[model samples]
Target: MKLFNSLLLVLIIVLNFMFAEPSLADPPKITKSPDYVEVTKSLDILQGQLAATKSGQARSETLSAEDLQKKIDELSFQKYALEKGINWGQCRNETDKTIAVYGPKPKKPKTPYDNTLYFLGAGQATPTNWDCQGIYLPNDTKLTSLNTDPNQQLEGAIAIKIFKGTQLIAKNDPETGALELNISPSKFFKSGEINWYIPNVSERNIAFRVPDVPLGGEEETD
Candidate 1:
């Protein structure tokens, strides 16, 4: 009787093992698209290059020609990728929103004097006297001047005179020899010429010019 009970138990265990289901394997991982992968790799390379350039610049050294060219090429590639709707590791939904808000945002159109301010000239002027000189400048122009004369010291007040038909419309006194003047479109509507005057014995070496128009749009005015 004992031998029969043991055989019955063994038979039940064998049946259970034979009838059990096999465990399923995990699903395969989905990878990023080829373009996406390429963009990520390019971004990594660009970051490294930029870091190297920054480090070199911090030490007052310039990057080699080859390195510079490589950076340029990488930037070009990134531009191209962005134009083709490639996002830098961002999800598709987020990228779409960004594109909608910012539009294409392609490279800015190259203007004749983009971000450039031409150096008109430098000369000396007498103090307490106003020279009504004629000059042309665009609307919302900025003028910067520095005293280049080593012999003359900045001791008194200096003013920039804006004239329209021999009438003084506006004046700005910088006080110091180094001066900056921001000319608005409303103030300089009729004339582009301005006078440099100092109200003392000191002479001023003045330089003046206009900055290029901004690329996108007019800057916000205070």
Candidate 2:
């Protein structure tokens, strides 16, 4: 019985060690810098679907050859866009008081801080000594109101100044294409998961090719 137990214990340890061995595949070069591997994969899948559609039309009695061709063209454009990549800059700003936001017309999300990737900035919750983005406001002015109007949507690349109460805290640099932003919660803003408009990326997507900060301070970025 003792011998059997020892043998079993040795087998378990051997299995554990073998399983713990690290993978040998080369690490991706962009591990330190951001890269768009997921986007490429999505394009690949779309292309595959387009191929499958073509194959199906060959076997199907219902889809006319012309319809199949149209599908190919549409999916081709989508795949091309994915390959080109979309540039979008977003940020998260927070406040003790309620923050407001608007835009991306045809509003699916009804409130600010819904679920988009964004930079984080905090302004004064109280009136006095309230310095946000180097700005001060009157007590009744309420900083949250600055970017609260959902009726107005900012598009094409442009610098964005974030505020809380009466203070300007952070700024987002402009880009040449579509983007999303998050300006709320005022706290819990910096955590990366709160990344503002990642998956929601759509037609207006532009590539955020440059490093986040310009000649200004680092806080100007995420």
Candidate 3:
């Protein structure tokens, strides 16, 4: 009986070591830029494929272990290149629905502002690939994932203004030093989001303004 018990204990120890899974990896901590988002997503898919292959899952039939490993290595390199080496300016789409994103308008207007970058699906986060200037979330005059035309994107878009500069991006005092703007690496709509609220004070020179809540059903339509 004692000999049998000893043998069983050894087997359990060996099995535990053999079957133990690795700890989960931390999320990438890059700026939440477009390139960063795309690369991280591709990397995730590649890694998942490789994992499935190792586990003898359905992906195993399509990808041999060697091929899958090679693909993962290549994508990992792309992910590293996008890493900013620090986790700053990170943002996540905390909503249940997709929301459109925007970057700063280029200093020059050689091309029209797209007004919308990409629609971040729910629970997705900005990766730590490129530097983030800051993401603009619109509350009104919404563009969507479907609107591809640049000219059409600007309709009811944030106006170029003197004090606040535009909607969803204003200061409380409307002056140089104000604590109105929020920081990133944050949960949108979680605490208090600083989205667009179209008011007359935004840009009178533009000679037009959209409603604070747009007439249509675009509610980010976040």
Most accurate candidate by TM-score = 3
TM-score order, best first, reads 3, 2, 1
Worst 10 residues of 3 by lDDT: 159-168
Candidate maximizing lDDT: 3
TM-score comparison, 1 vs 2, better candidate: 2
User: How does each model score on lDDT?
Assistant: 0.32, 0.33, 0.40
Error (Å) of candidate 3 at residue 19 is 44
TM-score per model over all chains: 0.17, 0.23, 0.26
Segments of candidate 1 deviating more than 4 angstroms? 1-31, 57-79, 82-222
* Model 2 TM: 0.23
Where is model 2 poorest over a 10-residue stretch in terms of lDDT?
A: 130-139
Model 1: lowest-lDDT 10 consecutive positions: 93-102
lDDT of 2 by residue, 109-154 (tens): 3444432222222331222221122121112221232335433442
Clashes of each: 1, 28, 8
Mark the regions of model 2 whose C-alpha exceeds 4 Å error after superposition.
1-25, 31-35, 57-215, 218-222
Model 2, residue 64: distance off in Å is 12
* Candidate 3, 83-190: lDDT as tens digits: 735323343445444433443333343333333233344455544422223443332322232134312333333322111111122222233222133321112231
Candidate 3 lDDT at 218 equals 31
